[model samples]
Target: MAHAQDASLVARDDIPKTFDDVIPGGQDFTRKEVMIPMRDGTKLFTVIIIPKGAKDAPMILTRTPYNAGERAGNPKAMTIGDAVPLADAAFVEAGYIRVYQDVRGKYGSEGKYIMMYPPRGPLNPTKTDETTDGWDTIDWLVKHIPESNGRVGMIGSSYEGETVAMALLDPHPALKAAVPESPMIDTYMGDDWFHYGAFRQMMLGYVHMQTVQKGAGAVTPTDTYDKYEEYLRAGSVGDYIRSRGLEKLPFVARMMAHPAYDSFWQGQDLARLMAAKPSNVPTLWEQGLFDQEDMWGANHAWLALKAAGHAANNWLVMGPWSHSQVNGKGYNVGPFKWEGDTARFYNRQMVLPFFEQYLRDGQPAKLARVNIYNTGDDRWDAFDDWPTSCAKGCGTALTPLYLSKGASLAFDKPADAQAADTYVSDPAKPVPFLPRPVLDPFFGYGTDFAGYIPWSSWLLHDQRFVDGRSDVLTYETPVLTSAVRVQGTPKVDLRAMTTGTDGDFVVKLIDVFPPSVPSDPAMGGYQMAIAMDILRGRYRESFEHPTAIPANTPQAYAFELPNVNHVFKPGHRIMVQVQSTLFPLYDRNPQTFVPNIFNAKPGDYQPATITVLRSDSQPSAVWLPVVGKSTTP
Candidate 1:
């Protein structure tokens, strides 16, 4: 046996620097290319990764649209593709057989790609979905695998996470546990595309990438990868969209038309399906605080499951990593500040022990309800239950920081303020989000700095990167007297009267820090930056049913910003900004009630007055979940 220190130092010199390097204790597990036949006689292709000696071993089932071949095989140094299988490999080596199966219509599978499923209308009924297929695959795997312990656990990320949620709906008898990492809980509220009501540009961009990847048989084409590099270097989403002609994709057209949460999007909600008689199987849910893709899904799912009275058997783990950072495995930024044995805790302590106890008759009682990683003041905390308290002492504060023309922090009345700082967000010159030359991968996949520093201008060279735009309003607080620890959703209560019948509101919470001494050449100064999160808003007053705002009436707008596990330290300040448009981060709000941004002409666009009345009577403020702050700020 190799010593711990020596084992950590071991690496293959022969292999080139690639995604495969991250796989710990890599091995050629027995691979069998077989068909996972669905109940309807529809055969789904699968690749099972079994331990060297597999007889009566518990199985970890994963159903993905991303393909089983790619999961078992090796790929380049991409984000999500890299750490997925490596994280699961730990379980495989620990006497668990891994079953990776493709959904009905994906690479190597014998069906048509159903786009995003759970079906919207007549296109895909309840009978045809990844969930149904996933259930079928698990049923087959538990019975057929000679080395099966009959007890099984499911695991996945993103779309795969959706698969895990699907498995929870009327799951098989053999399925005993699940770990849905960053699951997609709802598509309408903010899972796949529409956030609040406005569309998410990065999500649509991801759809194009997935379409191309799946089209190419789920294999990373060197040409496509090179093209992606070229696109990233272009510095804008428009350039990438133009380069790929993706503006013409059906998804874009459909998204552009549907500005409200209609039935078309509601059908994709997995929470509805799993709401009743929620899965009896204990769940080990994991998510990334920085995972721009589906962190909201996990955050919301955690709440929903708890509300459903899912007691004791479930555990939730959220970290400060992106989509691919599960198991704490990655390059350069695995355990952020921690040294080695990063991936070991999640695998050895949380996941492996979880399955071992429930499936293999090992101790399972030790698993707590919540094992979350707090990033702001980096540390791990184990909670006996999810925090569901919304009382005055709940973990959040509703504080308003008024916006003024000059860059200043204020907690005063808006009427006293001389001018409101405004910036025009031209669709032609939309703020470049991800895949912009400097940080393409970060923006493209929508998985960048959701849980770290607060330097927005540093990432992009523009100082007005978020300021001076009429679309966005800025507010900040004086240096904090105490460490303001906020966990859970942040909401913005806007007091404004709009000219348009229907419109959208976008809110962002930023961690404003004082200028840093120029130790590095890249950036300097009092960087007013966004720490993590780019939460969107669509006038909640009208969701599926879009009701026009009364021509001259004040409206109260309440929408959630991204959930945070942030601590605004004593010296650092907490800031909240409100805006109507966030550009390529989200689709342009159009400011007026138009059918959709896709077909709306310039003539169709209208300028509307957005007023923020800041007074004791009509106070507009930011709501944050501070650990010890009173709800009324």
Candidate 2:
């Protein structure tokens, strides 16, 4: 007891209170856990991995709702490189500090979670938005981390990608560079939630998986071999999701409440938010040509940035990937093959080099304004601008590919006085998006990973599957004698009369492969959909306000399909297949109009006969941006 008073035995005020002080300074890398405080006094859980000899290294930060520590690496990673996620492999090997954090209200972060939280001062009552949180984290890093050179970079994919994107709104001075890949921005426009107001039925399971807990909840198994059966048996979109007991979830309940693109969704849209005050941060945007979940969020945001006059520091890198595939081996997408390992080439040749120039004090980055992996030709094409072969500056025009009698698609307007194609669209026997016995977005992440045709490559599905159906109107141009390179969003113009008050229209721009392929015979006669989209008839006048269509009256419906940069080579055919329903991919339109589709019952769905017309007065054509002299085949 007497020895307890000794100076050595006494607990000194300077003594370390944590194990972080005991970390030896001689390892290849050191991992530390911390709680980063926000302006609102909320402490977010953070994981920092500082390389062994990392002095003056620029930190690469990734903020995620997903767990940070679990994604750092395997439970038994021996080195920093091994510890790094596949997407961050190249950056970490280059001696960059890797930092990950769980967003507020998720995992270890202390706060109430709001799914798809908007910026402060809008609908958001809280002052601590992603922008504020990002600034605080960057400030803390630059001041506390002695090894860092005080420069920071941000990069992430999917929801994490949105964090990087939102940081651009009011970026920290220390944040020098950023990359947002396959970001989920506008949920209502063309992203995870809806495409032109048509609800994406595939996202029902995903919503439950993402929001059922502090972290990601368990994947709600469909409990059946075929998801189609489960959905079909559920009667309505509301019934299907309600059966899964998701009616009580906050975000889902809110989404159900707001079916139209009203103030609720407009306030949440990142694309609109970014454009209102376009950021000047040197940002590199990425989008997958066939992203299943978020096909156009990044594309729309980048275009919005350009349109808002912030084009100088803005750049884009588009690849033939499906939702974050650039982070892995990308030799091909489904049956389509690339020239080389596109993902590796992108990360090493483009991504790392681009960051090296912006994040560090080094040589100026020599990168194209837009780096696009052209799918049809399988080549990396660089341009000073995107949709380069578009209507205005390029001196080119969007040639109309008209729909004619005898089920033909031609570049010239139909000479026929009057022509019409009619089909019966039954909500009950809706056309399937892909071949049935279709499983859950089947995809394997092995080396040389080519995603499944039904899920990852559903955008590239064979059109022949739906051609023979009586509900579809098939139109095809003659075989192309010369290569026709198309490079922009194709506009679909349909003048149609429907027996029902409401309907949905689906358009597919396809390239029918030749009868045989010498290199890969399995690709023989493949009817690949180069670009496609669906527009709900209700949103014809205004996306924000929907109105029912007049039954049995010809109405003009015009909308742009997804972006395309592909070439139809010699001997291939250009085809257009028009159908009313995309099946379980999108909720049934219930040929009978309802106030809200989510509130719709089984009785609302009915059969309707749709007639597509082509004439001088009501000419229906899909305007294609053909890049060559010979517009027609």
TM-score: which candidate is best?
A: 2
1-633: candidate 1 lDDT, tens digit per residue: 569767766664646676434445554456678997787788888987665567888988888777688776543323222323668756766777777888877788887665666542354655666757777887888778887888888888888888888778777888888888888888667665656766655454456666654444221212343322443343333334544566576665565556566766666666655655578888878876666556467767766777777765567887656664664462323223433344456776788888888888887548667776665566666766545223244443445455433545455555643243334434444443433332323233343544332212222222345564556666666667767666665666666656655555656667655455355323233333323333222345667776556644667877666656666666666666665654455555455554544444455456666665554456566655556652211
Model 2, runs deviating above 4 Å: 1-27, 221-223, 391-395, 442-454
Q: Candidate 2, residue 308: CA error in Å?
A: 1.5
Residue-wise C-alpha lDDT for candidate 2, range 297-359, written one tens digit per residue: 888888889989988988898898888898788898777889989888888888788788888
Local distance difference test, each candidate = 0.60, 0.84
TM-score of each: 0.79, 0.93
Reference-based lDDT, residue 319, model 2: 90
Per-candidate Cα RMSD to the true structure, in Å, reads 9.2, 5.8
TM-score of candidate 2 to 2 decimals: 0.93
How does residue 339 of candidate 2 score in lDDT? 90
Q: Model 1 has how many clashing residue pairs?
A: 15
Candidate 2 residue pairs that clash: 28-52
